[model samples]
Target: MCGRVALASRDAVKACAGVDRELTSPTPLERDGEWARAGGRNASPGCAIAAVRIAAVEADDDGASARLARATVGDRRACAIEDVVWGVRFDSRRGGNFERSFNARVEGLLGGDESTFAAKLAKTVNGRCVVYVDGFYEWREEGPKGAKTRVKQPYMVRRADGKPLALASVLTPEKARSDAVDDFPRREAAVITMPSAGGELAWLHDRQPLFLWNDRDFDEWLFGDWARMARERRAKDVKGLLQWHPVTTKINHAAYDGEDASAPVKRAVEKDAGSVAALFAAATKKRKVDDETAVQID
Candidate 1:
């Protein structure tokens, strides 16, 4: 459901993850300042990838200690800020392509069909990670379903307090082998998604990314046994955790990157609305559902 996301600054990501000073930036960012700058804005797979902070136990002079490091979606090495590919590659030996593995369903990861390749990998390897993003984009379909005249209105979802959101994700080595000769093996990551049964943002889509906004939540997701943890926390409510506002349609075009690409634009229907609170209230009350389903945390 999370097709596009906007990342925070490099320093912000490091601060959020509490990265150690000894850790260094990835090679790509070290050689190119522009690439690092672009990471602050809306990032699409292949063109730009968000930095992920990972924590692991390593053997050192002190025996075993937990350390914080960085890795992109598909980096094969450890303790380095590796630039991994965005989409999860399918194993070539299986004769399938890496087309739709970018987003992993929360149900699948939390004890679904284990016969699939992704489910098997998720169960075997604890590839837990925190994806730092300023916000994300979604679309709401207008008009009747399956109608030819249906139009999708773009919306930008972000914290109501305007802080960075730490999204929980799962990573895996690139499934498909690349022909290009690269020094490191490619890797890919998928944002874990849950059913958006109830929320202000439910109007936009039926699924939303699992968010770990605080330190305690992040620690549980990153280090704890998430499958068990998710079951225990399944009753928690996530409504009003985020706010969604209609944005310019320019975000639909991947090539379009204007100053207002991610900015909230006045909705044509509510152009004369006097205040933002009124607009948000209207959206919240538009489709009142009493039986709001609880969000499952994983």
Candidate 2:
């Protein structure tokens, strides 16, 4: 499951879509008094990730400078970049805080019997969304020989060409119901993940975001019938086009975010001399992350 993700910037998503007229969604999670600048480089849950979705656009806001933010494709339906929280929406019936479901498994949605949640998402035209990110982080647990408690190494995964990665996601019902951008609804979403292509990528994690290859795929995923796509397992196979490597552990901190936080670095591993006790001791030393950082990981 993806716990954290990174984006180059909002401009990257616009460039990737090559679309016109963007609606600047200001949904209030700002740290520097700027809304667009929030959840930037190293983004985690609760952060607003930019997502492209088809929405009804009125004639006035089509080119007007209200936000000059979201792009427009036509007079009726247009592709707009929406601010989507990286997790499921809250349900009051649950009473206390309910951990949001951020990742949706393909097995439940496509591979095996379709899940009721996925089924509803598939049928809801407004629920489909496209999220673009630069890369995502995954941790691999390793041990120094025979240590019981293994240390985890972080890795950043991205396209080989370093282009924006288009992820398939489902949005909350409130996102696109309004035709205007100023409605400013606080929306949430979950990324759909499929089993990883079994080679080098399997080493990092067992699942990966369902990817859209190009503009054609973007159209199909957002408009095409979900059952057909699911039956064919039509998600673009990205096995050869992706590259990943070890990254620094600074990302473990909730406060540590920026381009440098996700930068690639030499692998950090414990050098073991073969003793079980020595191996266990070496593994124990890497758990230097503080309590606050650990909370971010969860």
Candidate 3:
């Protein structure tokens, strides 16, 4: 299964470098150890990093395979889909950078137009979502699913409260992939900047933890809906630019602990280095029939 990590709070950036330091180093537990050793005051202990096991599940048929693969790519491609992630913005610019970054990774790996993927993704999932921008879990539901809105495909999504924002989806991955590009990258990378309910702040390299963010971006975003347009009409011009954390995850084997007899079981995430390494390995494993893990997008 695909796994991700996210940190909480605005000041979480302060702890990022330390996490990165352990990620790039030769040892695995060093990063987490360093953070723990630093104590709560030294680092923003509010950061929560959780790892999710995305089993390499196989589909039953062409439609199922297509759906599963598409959903995997689309969901994995878009960092916001993971359940462990939180604090994603729910405003109109919600999916902003996260969407584009996903498209870019797919395009770079699969060789297709990022816009095409974005457009398909726009159509695939709309409404039926809630976003947490402060690296915490929050929910809001609105919009239609599997149908086009008058404004455009992949429009900016807003939260019920009308403040935090993010790109949302009500459509299934199979539907989203029907219009998605085929050459989407098999490998991907992203970073989770926001904190999670677990209270840990750090960058992820592989199958370690689940934190939200890394799906918002400028190029792959669409905030030109009626609400935005109407707001633009009433006020001065506004520029919408999306940004994703440079933190990354990849698709490969060795990400999960396959060495044990029970290969499909979720692995432990005690050490940042070990878990992060596993995250990348899991990204590449082919979907098997057993790779089913449900995440509530709504």
Candidate 4:
């Protein structure tokens, strides 16, 4: 059996627009319509690669000046397309004034119909999308513990270009809710794991609005709070709530696969709060990221 691979090209922006069509070519007429659609072209097990564009906008600086940052890739180019791996960490947090931390829904990008968690999590497709947020179901349960989970997955966003706009899926519930409308809507954040300041696990990707929360710290808090709530029968609230699911990165070079590409990229961008444009630019050249093994995902 041939395994699917990921690929990225120089003209990624233009190429990604037609990614769905290329991947959707017809199969053999005998196998079905795939062959007829492809004019008898055989399916290749080669990895697929696509591209996305992240626009840069000006933000208000602490000094009250307007600062504009360029996009990650040059105007002619878009962000790098990488393959999805098990090591890239992801989490979704729900934080707001009106609802419990755990008040949100988590849905699969690919259709959910498997007995195993791994199968369910691997459903992300070209146009796969999910809507996550908190919900409250009241029933005949005793104490603060409700009869059902705090949230439900309700809405999803459309995938524009191939480069999945924002990856890190975090839903912050609104402070107030009404019986007429939905509560927490999705707010996209680019989720990447970078090494810690001391050179641990801090990740980076495009320069976009970011939420900084250490993976280990956040996971520990989530599990602890969830356990406490379950035991005390007082599911008062889950603090520092987040939400997220794994997304398949574009199939790229073999370098990012397996144990060989496991090392984390050193900080091209500093951990402190500041403008990342200059930092991102400096690092790509200064650190010679292109030569690095895990530079591109696919």
Report the lDDT tens digits of candidate 3 across residue range 120-202: 33222221122223121111122345435321111111122322223222111322223223322111222221122222211
Per-residue accuracy of model 1 over 62-176 as CA lDDT, tens digit each: 2122223222222223322334445565546455633546677777766678875546545433355556677888876654577666555678888877777767677664445
Clashes of 2: 11
lDDT score, candidate 4, position 123: 24
The lDDT of each candidate is 0.57, 0.66, 0.23, 0.22
Worst 10 residues of 4 by lDDT: 130-139
Models, CA RMSD each: 13.9, 11.9, 26.4, 26.7
Cα displacement (Å) at residue 230, model 2:
3.6
| Candidate numbers, best TM-score first, in rank order | 2, 1, 3, 4
- TM-score of candidate 1 on Cα atoms, chains taken together: 0.68
Question: What are the models' TM-scores?
Answer: 0.68, 0.73, 0.19, 0.17
User: By descending lDDT, how would the candidates be arranged?
Assistant: 2, 1, 3, 4
Worst 10 residues of 2 by lDDT: 65-74
As for TM-score, the candidate ahead, 1 or 2, is 2
